[model samples]
Target chain A: MSNFPPAGVFLVGALLLPLVPRRVRAVALLMPPVASLVLLWILEPGQTLTVPFLDFQLLLTRVDRLSLAFGYVFVIVTFLGGVYGLHLKDVGQQVAALLYSGSALGVVFAGDLFTLFVFWEVMAVASVYLIWARGTKRSRQAGYRYLFVHMAGGSLLLAGALIHYNATGSLLFEPMKGGLGATLILVSFAINAAIPPLHAWLPDAYPQGTVTGSVFLSAFTTKAAVYALARGFAGWEVLVWAGTAMAVYGVVYAVLENDIRGILAYHIVSQVGYMVAGVGLGTEVAINGTTAHAFTHILYKGLLFMGAGTVLYATGRSKLTELGGLWRALPLALGLYMVGAFSISGFPLFSGFVSKSMTVYAAEVDHRGLVVLLLNLASVGTFLHTGLKLPYFTWFGPSRPAAPQTRVPWNMYAGMGLAAAINIAIGLYPGLLYELLPFPVDYRPYTFAHVSETLQLLLFTGLGFWLLIKMLKGEPIITLDTDWFYRRPARLVYVIAVVYPSHLFATTERIALRLVQSLVSASRDPIAALNAATVTLFGRYPDGRMPRRRHNTGDYDPDRYRLPVGVMGLVILALFVALMLWILLAR
Target chain B: MKSTWLVLVVVTLVLTVSGDILTRKGEYGQWWYPVPGFFALLGLLGCMAIVVVSKLLGRYWLQRREDYYGDSGAGE
Candidate 1:
């Protein structure tokens, strides 16, 4: 049992899901995460499971305070996600969620870079299926694009790992010294972290994912990236400015977004920015703050996504423009979601007040004035959009025509309620979370000054929202983003390169065939053919001036122009030979 | 809605008046604590700036028609 990594339970359980009866599958899903939690506590810190691979030792289980913190929250979220998705009959999503969660655990516990990479790729592939499980045309395309982007990120990570291994002759995952390998690895992590430019994929694909799937999607990818960064790239100064930019950038986009999930998606970027900044600050307090925030963020953000998913589940719509007057309809969901919203916005008595403020305080102690200011500004924006605007527009804005409401599953509420309880529990008593941090906890979150300051900030931001309510109304329009550069132009380039060329080639081939046919026929009957050719060439037909030539119904037989089998074979052989020569000579 | 606004105003005033007595710690400490509604002002102005800047970005550049991607539905 000690030899088996905790992640192995989830992965194995995921495989067993299809074989079990439907009713048992939920219990099966719940068991692994619960069992993993137990196993997590039982196991001592340090490498536990090691296997001999081709040339390196594969360290599968590395239990330390850092990994265990992530592990605890990961298992908790997986259990909540499992409970939330209990009503889903789709086995594919269920299995994918388990695999995705397992791979994330795999990443966190991985003691070596190779082990991390394998699990990283698995996480990407498994999560894309969740998006595709939405089974909409939009989701299908989004999944493809999501896959494309992750593939690119994964390739970069592989390249970095290979290069790092080559340079150091070690496969152990440790703090990277600044170099090409480190830069590539950091970039790969940044892309997953949804640092801007690479960030559009989060807002693009996440909103399009299945209701429950998006909930799972929200928890894993960026948080895993945060974990990776905290372990590997702490104290990298560039991340400080980059993370500040991400914090502000995400909220700005969230403010403009109309879709509830899209707003949340951008807010993920904003919230992750805080963690990234904490990691960038690189002090013990800051790193602890970063991990602590990741812990709290997983709960509240998962709850928020669950709230949005609840809205989507009930109305068959996610856009704020199509929703309103749901306060009476979904008061329970509203209340539960508000807990998450307030926590994320750093309300005085909630989790964000405790967790988020630690990072801000760290920045202050470190004299990172600019980062503190930007993070504070982002907090204001967070309240404006998530804590206030989203709830108002979706639940209490001017009533639109009533949407056909579906009964929300009890499991969804149960999942959200569980998460909300934890949020408040941590908020009201952060010692519960702080004791689990890697570093010693010395910060206080509930001082009279801190409370008043936070209340003042939030309440005043509320006032601004009230004053600007009209200006803040959701429009039935899309906001163009960094993705427009690729999504639009890439398609246009595809048309020019692939579509147009193929069409032009077909037309040109037809014309060439007509010319060839005319020459061959002319050669067969020289005298008559010469007369006709002369008339056509001289622009003098049988009619008085020049009769229009009738277009031939060109029965183009492409088969007739096909190369002989022997010649085709030779051509293929020559190409193969050339390729071989290039490979051999190049090496 | 009217009552809500009225209550919010009353609460803001109450918090503003009471903020002077709270024990201050961390950045700026007690030096800035006595200033009435200091954080309230920051929050209000910070929110306004976020709105103004985001609106400007939307107006000049980011905002597009819902169908900006056309038949491909790529942006969705």
Candidate 2:
């Protein structure tokens, strides 16, 4: 009832959107970003409130530097995404993206674990409809897998929260000493963030989404999980290695992928790796890096998805092998894509360089040698695939006969341009991003030595790629990932498991059918004979019952067959005995 | 695929062996010493083996294709 709009605003909009005409839904979608901004400006910093009689309390909103920076970037992303997706046919998608993104923002501002969990599940359930909206069977199947993984993660989080409550006797979201409960919570975040070995869901779901749906999907789930990790486990040392593995793992798979959207999906896992590693470093500088990198990544990644979305919308193609020489027609998209590529590659004077250097610097200062080395290698791989290969193959490579030659529309350009401008602005003035971090900033990113070293590393990595391409003989086919573990073998297992029991039941049913048919055929003539005899004998009696006739032995009455009570009672007793036996055997 | 499986197996075995050797209890903080270093080296070596084997075997089996789903379209 307060002036502040409740989280229900988003949920209601999502449910009501499809009921509205398509034309009006586009304008109505603007509510989320506007509402998010108003809430941001109105909410004071260092705020806390607990409503009585509720296990979950509203953490109205927190406007610290970190939350403010993330909130602003998320709102901007949602706006650009709205413009980008204006041509979408489905209102369900537009509404879901808004609600999903807003709920994610809600989590970032949440001051307690209970409020965060509430928003967390909302984001998961709301965002998945984007994947399902693709209208492809592959996408539907992928959506199922996506839902299962997320619901599992949610259950783990809920269980961990209950355990944590028992251990700490409080619902406040604070850092915990590592144990079974804390580890469970961390694993929950790790699964969503696409941590290695459990990281199959990102590539599985994102590529199958509708062109614009992928753009919105890219921004929320994993990054929100990263925000939660930073909030809850900023200093945990293990995430350094976990993050580094994801960084390298994603890049390796990306280099082998032919699907343009798949490449971006894998890169999501890799980019978040930087933030995860930064969190593990557990210093103020590293935390700043996590926040800044997440902010910049959203812009650049959204830009990249926007670019891919343009290709899909215009030509109906997202595979690299099927797309080429697009720069000739879609020059705006190509240029916008390059801006995103440069930002992601951490090139000098781009968003990535400005943000990522903080983490590298923190790692060096902290003396995490192996983690530093893996991240460095991953940076090279990142450039090879996303920065260079994606643009090289999609826009500038040999022209394909099937490639689309149409120019993209103006709204698409506007979306990409907004994101590109933000990338460059953040790169040119890192302080703008630095001021909005969760903590005060004392670090500098533009020192001569820092800039020089970054250039040297990138230059050498570029050289390595050149030499490897020239010297090493490697295949260009897409490499299989852990997804095949479930998508193939596990799917086969599911089929066998479901089909096997059903197959046995089918056999039993056939036998039962045959037995009943034979029994029916055998009893037909005898039943007719018995009917004739009963009618003749019963007609002689006043009542419709025949008088009892003595049996051949003259001891028993023959009228018992007409007494259905005796026959039915005997049948009931037999069935009860059989059912009891079956239960005993089952036990 | 065979090579990848081989690498996975070898690295897991080496890690189990080394974890037994390296892992120990600590009085203050949980302590892990350098015995896992051997396992890490083995893993790096395994990665190399996988890259090499995948490269070699891919020449015969991995033909680039137009449809990755390998059917007219994917079954949902």
Candidate 2: residue pairs that collide: A66-A437, A66-A438
Q: How do the residues A1-587 of candidate 1 rate in per-residue lDDT, one tens digit apiece?
A: 76478889899989988999987787678888998988888877765788999977899988788998999999999999999988888889999999999999999999998999999999999999999988888898879888899989998999999999889988888888877887888989999999998888899999999988998899999999999999999999988888889999998998789899999999999999999999999999999899999999999999999999999999888888888988888999999999999999998768888999999888888877678878988999998999899999899999876464799989999999999999999998999999899989999988766777778788888888988888888888889988888788987899999999999999999999999998998677664465466565775533334434444212233464577789989999999999999999999
Tell me the lDDT of model 1 at A201: 87
Which prediction has the highest TM-score against the true structure?
A: 1
Q: Interface RMSD for each candidate model?
A: 2.8, 11.9
- Candidate 1 lDDT for residue A496: 92
Q: Put down candidate 2 lDDT per residue, A1-587, tens digits, no spaces.
A: 22243344555666777778877787677676777677666655555444543655555554466667777777878888888876666777887897898788777776666777778888888888999998887788789889888898888988888888888877777777877778888989898899988889899889888878888889988888888898889899898888888888787677556678888988999889999999888898898888888999999999999998888878887777777787777888888898998899888899999888788777877867677667766776677677767777777766786456465667778879988998999999988888778888888888654554455445444444444542232223555566666665765686789888899999999999999985675476554445445555664233354545532211223474477677889999999999999999999
- DockQ of candidate model 1: 0.50
Give the candidate number with the greatest lDDT: 1
True contacts kept of each: 0.63, 0.07
The models' CA-based lDDT, in order, is 0.87, 0.74
- Global lDDT of model 1: 0.87
Considering the two chains of model 1, state its CAPRI-style docking category.
medium
Each candidate's DockQ score against the native complex?
0.50, 0.05
TM-score of chain B of 1: 0.57
